[model samples]
Target: MTSAAAVPTSLLRPAVNTAHAARVSVLAPTNKAHLGNLEHLFRNRGAVESTATAAAAPVQPVRRRRQAPLLRLPSFLKRARGDVAAIATQEEQVYLSPRLFQPVPPDGPSPRGDIAAAWQRLHGADGWRGLLDPLHPDLRREIVRYGEFVDAAYGAFLARPDAAPGDADAVRVPLHDPAYRVTAPLFATSSVGLPSLLALAAPCAAQRTSLVGYVAVCENQDEVRRMGRRDIVIALRGTCTVLEWAENVRAGLVPATEAADAAPSTGDASAPKVECGFWNLYKTAGDGSPSLSEMVVSEVRMLLKKYEGEEVSITVTGHSLGAALAVLIADELAGDGGAPTPVAVFSFGGPRVGNRAFAERVEARGARVLRVVNAHDVVPHLPPRPGGRWYADVGRELRLDSRASPYLRPDADAGCCHDLEAYIHLVDGFLSSHCPFRANAKRSILRLLKNQGANVKQLYISKAVDMRVRLDAVDMPGSPLGRLGTPPSTVLECVH
Candidate 1:
């Protein structure tokens, strides 16, 4: 467990809501349409008719009066408006690279802690919003979008048992059109083959909505096919179900022997270690829950056999308890030595699922593991480190810097940070950039196209400047009364 001192007090404080005063300057029209209005303003003496027809038709000859010259907005103002609009329309995203949090001291025994410290510094004190600008825009977008899909899979899982893929909220995002909906449903158990299971009532209706696993044929295979492989997405919903939380509370840490024994089939000499409870959760589907491991393996085999000769990659995703199971499933698939290896695993707000051995083995398998952690989410720090039991999280952790609030209070029994909604919000915020790209782009173009004079428009004037500076003019007495008339000394005092 990390000490209290490890977490900064500033991080615990409520976020400061800085309200910016927007200056809405209604200037003369810059575009032709608006310029027409300006022309009308000068011609009609600022009393132009509101009706479009009246404006369209020739205006009645107004008494010719001495009219002040028409006021046209400067070229800079036109460019600024165009630049602002272009920036507002452009898509901007933020990406945080794991490489950015490198080991401080470059070589040390506590590099992980150093990395954590570096992350805290960047996240806690940086002037920018918590996340770093995106290192890879496209990749970050894909990850963020997919995290949403995985979250929505819970709604799909909670739908009626007989619900088809295209059924109302059946699958959060559709895999296909209504005609090619996912028909095959995946199921898993509450307890890993534990005897005499307790069948609890479903939350809302007669139909049980707590089925564990989900797998569907890649209805939209464009992304996978692009990589020269067919794909199936398998999603495991988080611990909203009663028994799922019950299993989590059980919190019994056992050796990897039991999990290794329950493997569908063993791998070669070097096999990974995994959490016993999680392994059993996959293995034992009791009366209410279906055996997840068997079902998942069976589905994978069938898909491979059906699509023989084609390359297939399975992407597994989940959150919280479901994340733990997803890790186990990935480890199992990799160990089974199956045809379609688990290509990628995305676990959001996931708890540590296995010992160091398990993590190393999973890393060695060449599977892309992206573990997302919301700021100070309590669930991920779970099951306790009783008696020095070794439980560690797998994959590279992608931390989302969520503001601490009453709902997201770290000490609360029911963690607000653990909620998928919060995770989604943080993830989305991280994946988006509100940086003034249009303004920056225009500045860059102006610098390249025009001389130094044009670059003056790109300067940023601080809005917080104190304009009440003291300016005074005083006559300078000639030294030794030599010069009779001397120009007054202008004093310019600019306040900080």
Candidate 2:
């Protein structure tokens, strides 16, 4: 559980209504689209990914005008927003990052208190109407247009008997399936999935916990990719060849189906499902065994076997720590797991993964991995700037540095153009899931390119500086000197 201290009272402040003003004096359009938009600059051309949704016209960037205050929100939360001033530096230079939101109603008893419960009540299926941004004109239309998939995806899941009400939040199949849970998904995936798995791993900056996730995952893929000579299809009975499937996967052939088929299969009946990540907290082998990233990479090899030489859509998604885990799994697939399937990986609030060289390399190789974050959400800033001692990051590490807020100027370690909500608008643009990608079929295509699979657009993302509280000019929470320390009130923790 998050301790009250760790939770930060400031996070509980009023829904911030402040805006981070734009700093660029000359907002010039790119002649051919260089790495200008924080979203575009973050891309390493080689890391393009392919997606698996119905295609639409290629997205062209459009500028969004700053609008007036959308929702005033509760007063208590407002104080929190005012708190940013306590830490105000000599220059009051607030580092800025691109982030991207809308509105609602009135009525009986203003429901509130605690974000999670608040979301449940106001944004609940029945009361969600109370949360829209009244200032945004196309709000509901946006929801129906770009965001209908989330609802549809839910409906699709409901069609499956395994996707019962208890499974509503299961995330992936492995979390719900018991047959392979005990063995862990590792063993089943190793021989079958490692090839495709490593193919998906890319160079990373891995800032903060994302830094840890990247290091852990990158190292795992490095080992698996080194151990690449084996076949992908070693028979479960131990009689057939050990990983003959590797050759097939190398040639882009999918491996054979696993034993725990939706119907029936010939492989090991108890091999666990492969996808893995942090569920509240990520668990590792106490005896010093495989981590979730390792296990998932292993299962992916096996799972990809079924898709090898076959055309299939593979997408990986995670929120917070889970997003970090997703990166590792995707990386492993791209590098070592058998036969890379078209892949897309989406992570929310992820930290930087690598340096210019590594990011460039990933881009050159054609893989697409996108991240979404709110400007005030500071998890991505943890562990301090990479290359420093791990302890440098305790709160002091996060002190509103360039990496955390993006209010600072761009440097070698500065810029990242990961706005996904924009793309979501073209395909999945509306409905407004708090994570910023502009939802759509394009995002799926972008994911594929990152996985190194050839398919659609290859790569793209949403506009940063989303329509939420623009962290442009405002600094601390409240009062004269302005923007420092934890404010009793908050500004922009509002959610959809």
RMSD of each: 23.4, 23.1
Q: Tens-digit lDDT track for model 2 on 1-496?
A: 1122332243333221223112221221221121122332222111112222233222222222344333333232222111111212211111111111111121211112233222111111122232332112122232222122222222232233232222324323211111111112121111232344444562111101111111111122322232221112100100011232231122111111222123222234233212111211122321234444455555555555643553333344443433444444444455553454434444444444322333343333333454444444444553244454121110001011112111211231221222222222222222222212221112222221121111111122112222121221323221121222233232222222
- Global lDDT of model 2: 0.26
Rate residue 343 of model 2 by lDDT. 42
lDDT minimum window of 10 residues, candidate 2: 391-400
List, residue by residue over 103-154, the lDDT tens digit for candidate 1: 1121112111122222222221222133333312223333444454564466
Candidate 2 TM-score versus the reference: 0.27
Model 1 clash pairs? 94-134, 95-133, 95-134, 188-290, 189-285, 189-290, 191-284, 192-284, 193-284, 193-285
List the candidates' TM-scores in order.
Answer: 0.51, 0.27
Q: Name the regions of candidate 2 deviating beyond 4 angstroms.
A: 1-289, 383-496
